[model samples]
Target: MAQPYADTIACIRKSTAEMRDLQRGAMDLDAPGTEARLEQTVRELQARVDEQQAALEQLRSSSHVDIQQVAYASGNPRDKLKQLRAVTAAYTGLTTVAPFLPSKDSMLPALLAARALQQNIRGTKQAIASAEAQITANGALLKQEESNLHDANLIEKALRDRTVRLEAQIEDRSQKAPAQLAKELIAAKRAEKKRHDEETQRLGDALNDFVDNYLSAMLAAEELGGPVVGDMLNVENETLAAGFTKKGKAKATKKLVSGKTRQRRIDQIWGSKIAVEEEEEAPLTEAEAADAEMRELIGILFKTLTGPGGGRAYHQLERDSAASRFLIRAKIAQFHPKDAQKLRLIDFGRELDD
Candidate 1:
């Protein structure tokens, strides 16, 4: 299962890791070198414009003198001389300032280039703006993830504390009467184990069903041109199918054995089955159930001390509230440790007093 909060946290972390890289890219777009290059280009264009203006001014200042020289040197009729002078002066002006003229060919192209540069600068600014927005969004997501983690931590802590307290109570209770309590605790432990095994089996069954459905969906998707392809598709489908089939079978077997009839059969075959069978005949009140659970926990602890591979099992049980309590009681009863304190009886005579 994908936890959204956890995934969000992961994404946030990934974003944070890439922040420096993205920032670097953004910085490069407007770096000192880039800015310097742009400035240099603009300066060169300005210098060209200044030179053109100077040449145009110089041409305008000499146009009259050139016309007069042309008229005086031509030795022709007055009308012809005037026409020649006028034509020569016009030609001189055009030739002198032609290179400096801001032409339709030159000015238009320069204007377009300048506009393109401006657009690039605008795009860079927009990119920076987008990055900043992403950063803000990522920051908020990270904070939410942290809050979720904190809440989960608190819940885990509460569970742990309750488990520990229950264990201590069971320990104290078992010490009050060793032999009798031990037997009762053993029976309780067996019942508790049966429940735990059944619950675990149920969970396994559900998980198997989920896996099978998921695989079937994936296979269907692959057939429909989804992501699955080639060897990857074949391998994944085979692996998933095999695992789901095996788990489904195992869960079914466990569920079959979880019934009351199976319990009776086991009891008939095993004469040494503890006397706690009476509690299974009827649904217990909340108080009775709790006590029964605690006794079962103690029984588990006793088994841990005497049975093979029981130490680790006992330790694991201690981590669970109901299981831990039962183990503690069983341990206190079986060992009859002197330092173990008796549990204070509540008004219901079931729960340990505060």
Candidate 2:
């Protein structure tokens, strides 16, 4: 067999042996190791017996040949005389040529030499026939063995292909099956959501920073004689807006430019401060401080963006201008994702403007 196929078969056999061992272990927990050793000893004895049997067969085949005699012992006297005459003629012919032939012993008896040469020729013919039979048998056996090897190679290839398929299935089940894909998808989604949340948080922080700076700039501008908007809705103005029509005497007696009006407005403005002076002031929570800061920033931005006449500066920008695009992007980033998606669809295939 080829080396690779031999290795494959070895691997398969090893795997089969391991599986058999596991099965045997499961089937007989109390099986002794001595029993296995005994089985191995029996197998070895069987192999030795097979080898001896093959050797014995070869010996029997070799011993079956008969050694031919130089002369027949149970023939008629006339036939025996005839055979003697033939031997005499052969011996005479050999002696005549003996002077020209190479010989180890020149004085050896000619009759005995003729008889020995006759036996040797008969034995050689028998050996040649036996050798020819053995050659034919060997050729058949070689062809059979070649066929067996081809079959074994085919079986090995099939087993190797099956092993590859089984391994691929196992790999897919472990790493690419539906459950594995689902797990991967879930992990990817979680990662995407985490990234999205982080980006949103960063954008919010940036917006907050920008709002703080804008607020500080607006405050400085106001200090430099800008339009007064910080006190747009003071307590007195709120009171006047309420119209003072309630049946309560405090509301009914409220009049503009009166001492009571001034006192009520001052009281409303400083009520929390006065209460704090009377008792220990509690510190504001983080949420409360954030809300106050947000409210102040919103108030300033709202007043600045909307003029005293309540018309927004946003309404004055051209529809496709840079300022409009910035405003649109800011609104989309802030709170209009769904609307932005729709707008993006509408704007698809349209030429972009400045």
TM-scores for candidates 1 onward, in order: 0.22, 0.21
C-alpha-based local distance difference test score of model 1? 0.49
lDDT of 2 at 264: 49
Q: What are the clashing pairs of model 2? A: none
Q: Which stretches of candidate 2 lie over 4 Å from their true place?
A: 1-108, 179-354
For candidate 2, lDDT tens digit of each residue in 120-162?
A: 6566556656655766677789889999999999999999999
Off by over 4 Å in 1: 1-124, 136-144, 147-151, 190-354
lDDT of each: 0.49, 0.47
Question: Compared with the true structure, what per-residue lDDT tens digits does model 1 show for residues 54-100?
Answer: 98889879776554555454556886677777788989888877454
Q: How close is candidate 2 to the true structure, as a TM-score?
A: 0.21
